[model samples]
Target: MDKERLYDELRIFKDRHFLQQKLKSPLTVYVLLALSYLLITILFAVALSRVSVLSSQLNEMRKELKRNHSSEDFKLFPCGPEAREWEYFSGKCYYFSLRMTSWQRAKVLCEEKHSHLAIVNSHAKQNFIMYRTRDKRFWIGLSDQNAEGVWKWIDGSDSTTGFTYWKEGEPNDSNQNEDCAHVWTYGEWNDVHCTYECYYICEKPAPL
Candidate 1:
């Protein structure tokens, strides 16, 4: 009878220990699963935050490019910014001088400005020059500097086949003092003395 009671007590103790161990294992598993879930949630949230930030940066870059494109649209003129005050025509810039100087001095001034005297190569250009001069006279690029009767242009304009706006009975080289040419307000040209002081025009190619 004593042996039977000892066996029963041993069996009950063993069962109690097994129940405790089983309960502890389930609790540990639950804790590990909960921790894993929390870690996954945190990582997903971080990834979303990084994606949102990148999207915002991309949007800002697009806006900057749009602004730059808009600014470039305002610069439409073919001539450069330095020629804003000059007249732009046919890929050339014409500068009307406000000051007066002799023909030789005017040529020197135009050369110093990296340009040459205005050469009227076309009828449209001649009429444009005439309208711009108004009632004032301007010494043009034409001159007989090489020879007395051989009229030439400082800008190397070929007048043999080009148009001429010479006034009536002009270029007679009156009294041997008329070698340089000047344009009057009527668009007609007259040979004048080189020492005569007058307004002038300068011309140069416009920037592409």
Candidate 2:
């Protein structure tokens, strides 16, 4: 009877151990599934946050574009004798020359016409210049000739203190000689030698 009782106790312990092992596997699987769900939820939340921020930025950009396009300052006005040969915008007259010349000569020519080489200070003006100078390289009124890396507009204004739109990796002063600034047809600035010949744009204030 003692041997039979000992065998019954052994069977009970084996059944309990098997039950514990089965419970442990299911618990481990539940823990793993819970962690995976948590990770997926966090990732989805982050993605949603990024999408929201991007949507807001896109809306702001659209508003800005609309404002720029609808402003009367962006309109072209060619009125009176002073503006006959020039395109007027935002109280300024611009002359896009067809002849190519050295930067120095171009500056002198503009001055002779009672104007100066173009000094771009705003995006709207830059766009207008680009539209008028389509597919042509033109010299603007910017240079670092007086001091390397210290660009200044022809009006003696500091170029670093205001708006500037330089092409990527430009104004590199290639061969240690490039000092004059010119605009590409695509509306970005680059530095080249002042002696290099190119067409130019002139800017002057419109008469009140």
Model 2, range 1-107, lDDT digits (tens) per residue? Answer: 99999999999999999878876897877987999999999999999999999999999999998776545343444334435678787888888898999999999
- Tell me each candidate's RMSD, in Å, in order: 10.2, 19.5
**The candidate that achieves the highest TM-score relative to the unseen native structure:** 1
Q: After superposition, how far is residue 83 of candidate 2 from its true place, in Å?
A: 4.6
Candidate 1 local lDDT, residue 166: 91
**lDDT for position 149 in model 1:** 76
Clashes of each: 0, 0
Off by over 4 Å in 1: 1-78
Specify the highest-lDDT model's number: 2
Clashing pairs in 2: none
Instruction: Determine which window of 10 residues in candidate 1 has minimal summed lDDT.
Output: 73-82
lDDT of each: 0.85, 0.87
